[model samples]
Target: MELYRKTLTSATWWSLVIFNLLTFSSCKNQPESTVPSWKIKLIANSTSHVTYLVDLERAIDHILRVQLVQVPVFKGKELIVLQNIMALLDNFNPLYKYKKGKANIKNINRFIKSQTEVSQEYFKGLANDDEFATENYIGDDYIGCLGSQSGLRGFNCSLWNLFHYWTVQSSFSPELFQPGAVLWTLHGYVHHFMNCSECYLNFWFYVQEHQIEDVKTHDEEILWLWRAHNYFNRKLAGDVTEDPWFPKKQFPEDKYCRKCRWKGKWQNDKVLKYLKNIYSSISEVVGLINKEEEP
Candidate 1:
């Protein structure tokens, strides 16, 4: 009986030791799953309104690519032109004025000149034996030029007409080209099209008018915009709700539901318009190009 009891105790001790060893070994060997984190930072300063989207601790790498590498390669002169326009616009801001530092207007002009040269060279290479005019210049001829034929001309003309009617012969000036004004103008264009399904359908037709090759299919673009629209909506709304850091209280004036009403309305309107126009244009151009190829 003594021997049996001793044997039973020995077995129990050995079992407990083995169990503990197994548990420790399992825990030590277990792999950890990493979750990806995305961070979007909006930097609105005197000279630039920069929006940076990146993973945490990876901002420097992303910024280097965006500001130094990708912008030069992908956009080149177009980026410089945009930067110049943004800088000019930034100077007019009452809150923050752009200051010309080491890179003055001359530097900007030089950059623009360089970009134009690069663009011309690029076009020349593409033209090859064919005449330059024969090649499809959707963006270059139709969109880039300031002439009446340009789409931007049409957009600006429509905006000016609307603004003039509303304001009763308000003198048109560059001062009117504020970000808020631009946003409203874009909103109006979107609202106008969306209200008319036929016009909206026609808007896609107009995009097809551009006839860009290498453009995304209409269905694919629509799907992408739909996804993006939903994502932004969810992200912003979630930020408003889930983030304990954001203020929840109403202000003293609290006019327009403490600005939340305005925000929600504008956000939805702007996002929808942006998505619609981009998708419509891309789809239209691709469809047009494909149709032309078929015959």
Candidate 2:
């Protein structure tokens, strides 16, 4: 009986592999030939969404408190890359709107920017800053990127949403950023600061495969991320770490945005419009900001 069970398990795993390969081959009509050149066995889905400002803020807090400070070696090019990331967040993170929050982030960014060298102390100190410690911005709650199961999704998921949020925010005010600035800075962060080694390798591979550096326009930057996100969705569909309640599906399912697709083919223009609408504003947080910003 033990031998039979082992054989059955092996067969089932192979079956899943074959099934996924067949699905990939069937997607010949996808807009981009997203045939990932390398395969890394880890869960990643760029479909992470940021519905509330708190979700993005929490993700940033996690990076500062958990990822950056824990870096085994925290100096040289790695330190500079993190500084650029903080600078981008200070300048454009939509969630950093209220005066106190804005001031806190700017101070952190400036500290890092002006430093020729930094230590884990800098990132650790950020967690204890008056505003960060007193405010509940990084509390243990999640709104947009929450997973059904505890370990299924959390920081990595919110991080993807944060990236999308940055792109959309940059689109609204292109003059505030150099072309591809946000994406390039994020690429550096993932390359140098992201704690997940496999995730970083795969992201780097995807960037190279897709020519992420070549993206130059605001609209292109937004769509580029959306496309890469969908590609990961396709790759990670039914992955073991996928939350059963949140089965990976190509984003903007017809129900969520009916015009996003037609006859099983994505309508890029409609999809772009849908993305802009959903990512451009955070209505839920506006009232909170109004209440908090009151003098």
The C-alpha TM-scores of every prediction are: 0.23, 0.73
User: Given candidate 1, what's the lDDT at residue 96?
Assistant: 17
lDDT of 2 by residue, 126-189 (tens): 7566667555363445555555545445565677777777888778877777556665656556
Residue 101 accuracy (lDDT) in model 1:
20
Candidate 1 residue lDDT tens string, 44-108: 11122111111110221212222223222314434433333323323321111113222333343
**Please, what is the whole-model Cα lDDT of each candidate in the order they appear?**
0.25, 0.60
Q: Judged by TM-score, which candidate is best?
A: 2
Looking at candidate 2, what is the lDDT of residue 242?
64
In model 2, what lDDT does residue 89 have? Answer: 79
**C-alpha positional error of residue 172 in candidate 1 after TM-score superposition, expressed in Å:** 10
Off by over 4 Å in 1: 1-69, 74-106, 117-235, 239-243, 247-295
Highest lDDT against the true fold, candidate: 2
